[model samples]
Target: GRLVEWGGTRQIIKEPRQEYTNALVSVHEIEHQEQKPGTTPFLSVKNITAAYGRSHVKVLKNVSVDIYPGQTLAVVGESGSGKSTLARAITGLLPPEEGTVTFDGRPLANRLADRPKEDLRQLQMIYQMADVAMNPRQTVGTIIGRPLEFYFGLRGRQRDARVAELLDKIEMGKGFIDRYPAELSGGQKQRVCIARSLAAKPKLIICDEVTSALDPLVANGILKLLLELQKEENVAYLFITHDLATVKSIADSIAVMYRGEVVRYGAKSQVLAPPFDAYTDLLLSSVPEMEIGWLEKAIKGRRMASAGN
Candidate 1:
């Protein structure tokens, strides 16, 4: 309910003054070295404005961000903040009423259907729900191989071979190749979804809340695997999530969204550093700390801020 102390994970875990924080001795922060933005961006969304239906309500207001090759840009926001809408705009699922999307230095078509096959091949999406994302009736091999066959025309033994290789990459050995999605665990299912996207050999992947569904341990493993895959494949990621912990784990850069607008955007170190914007500060303060009386402190802080306003 409140944060008693904030410091390096090892320091807090080994020397917890608060009894509540003592229970978290076993927890460890994910090891990540935040990187600065590179000179060139692989995907650029410039001054985008989008709306839905006839309401004329702009879901995204002049949103813009740059994603570099082989890096992760984690978009953090509460629900209804337009983070996912930004993804939709980049993916061309919801064409932006204003602004342009440029990928690999080429301007992208406004609609997904209008994009060239090469454009389609280089951009992929891994959704949040692995269960619904895969066909219940399809075998694991078939599920993964469909993209290989569709994009590369691999067939028969060749497709099977590639599917097995992908399975190995996801750290699921070849034995699970013939099993159905119903038989796999949640993490395994998401790993399969990752393999499916990897099969496309994409330059950029839009991961929409990909880990929010799993247990903490399982989600940590997924994050580690994604980082490993990113290293080996040189693929950029647009990682959207509301979890600050997850953002700290995987992001090289970040964009903090609020009410259809980007309130903060920068390298991870810059965005997560001190002197936070009001919304970002509130979001950080709202994360439940392991320290005793954290909730009370948070409540009091909010009340004081409310009074000031």
Candidate 2:
């Protein structure tokens, strides 16, 4: 077999140090980013497997991650990567075909409806589409107040007062309490969803691509609001998204998933460091930059690297 050594260019030295047939890239570079440090594990999803339909097509394969109190665990991956499946499994909404979800110190029921009211109240999830998530006919006040009533039994003036408080926390005007979902802007509608989730006083909130639907500026503001609320409530977040920049901004621990498997998992610093896995490298290299000739430069870099091999 012909042998080759890879570098900036092919070096066809007949007298090589060792008999090598060919050089293949064994891995790719992938990176994660985060701030803050992990605390004791408040929520943990142990080895879990999930499937689609009854075809037994497994979409999630033995995936596990921990959400520590006062920290954010961001799950980053591309579309159809099973990020949302993992979220549902942990929340007991989709029920993992095999595995246990432990919260605080107790194991949660496999099905959400089977879980206790206390469990349901404490585990809140914000969906990507705020329009369909909230009832169109319900005013913002009723939407936010319902959680307070259902979870804490706050009634009459007490519930209304708490609703106003939550609206303030989400940076929505007090007047927004009376408006329906149709009356609010895209960002405002998402803010209502945030307010609703917070009204439950959940210890861990699963944010399922919460910002992907908003304008860039609005998304930034929403993220800032979440961070500020975290400081005030000491809540934990299981953030699911395909956005790397968001991962860099909010994650305490990052789990990079590919085709339903977690290829890389660690704190931001360790994961983002060099020697990235093959899939990770591809994903990282694919991030779009806002500059002239950026695409051409990236293509050139890849071509140059490929030429060496």
Candidate 3:
């Protein structure tokens, strides 16, 4: 046995005997287990241009972006500015009319039928309206368990256990397992939707205004939970929202869209700072501030400028 000093104090301890040494070896092996490097850009959009019809009302114009591991890229813009269209394009709900979307180094084909199940599993989406996204007839367990079963082949007790784990991860108790979506509140429903997306173990998730409908306090809680989950799971997020407040809280980078084009794209600090583009400045100024007279002053200024023009 060898003597070991205890902290900075004078106390000493004897080194492990054979049994103690063996236990320590086992503990070290368990603690040092190799972890796989986190997933990289599961989805990539390169110079993508999407349109609706022959007249070709373009919703995305030469848009290019990458979603890397454990990062949130917030796409912010005014209404009809093509934020949701960009999300749909990434998820393959709408194929790009021009350019390419690559997943895991492979370009996505023209049709969903050409895409593999693994590719589908690697990408999932959490839509804005929880009530509309969820089925009223199904119980919470069924809604959350379906993706686990589809992607992981989990069934019976294994599936149920996974669902419970997900619920716990989303900060919901097991008591809601048997309840239907109709029984839960807006925030809880959204949480269940999030758990369902996580069930597939996706590398990237498209969150389309997932917090806009909720109250401020509830939205903040959801944003905090999402940030925690990003840290733990190493999942990339394409957070599409009109709310700049939400972007400030969770976005690592910002892509400012205007009329279907990426006008400004960069790190949060750089894009949100002074010397912003005129549109970006307008968007930033629109966010409600704590000061009482800001809105009135902004409106008056806009009116004066319009009259001058």
Candidate achieving the largest lDDT: 1
lDDT of 1: 0.92
Q: Which structure is stronger by lDDT: 1 or 3?
A: 1
What lDDT would each prediction earn against the true structure?
0.92, 0.83, 0.83
TM-score between candidate 3 and the true structure: 0.84
- Show model 1 residue runs off by greater than 4 Å: 1-28
Taking the tens digit of each residue's C-alpha lDDT, what string does model 3 give over 11-33?
Answer: 11124345643342222121111
- Report the number of clashing residue pairs per model: 5, 7, 0
Clashes of 2: 7
Model 2 lDDT tens row, 1-309: 553454332232323333432211211111323555655589988889988787979999998888888888889989999999998888777788887889998999989889999999899999999999999999999999999998899999999999989998998868888898999999899899989999999999999999999876678777878888887998999999988777777778889999999999988777767899987777777776544567898899889879987
Model 2 regions more than 4 Å off: 1-39
CA lDDT, candidate 2, residue 195:
91
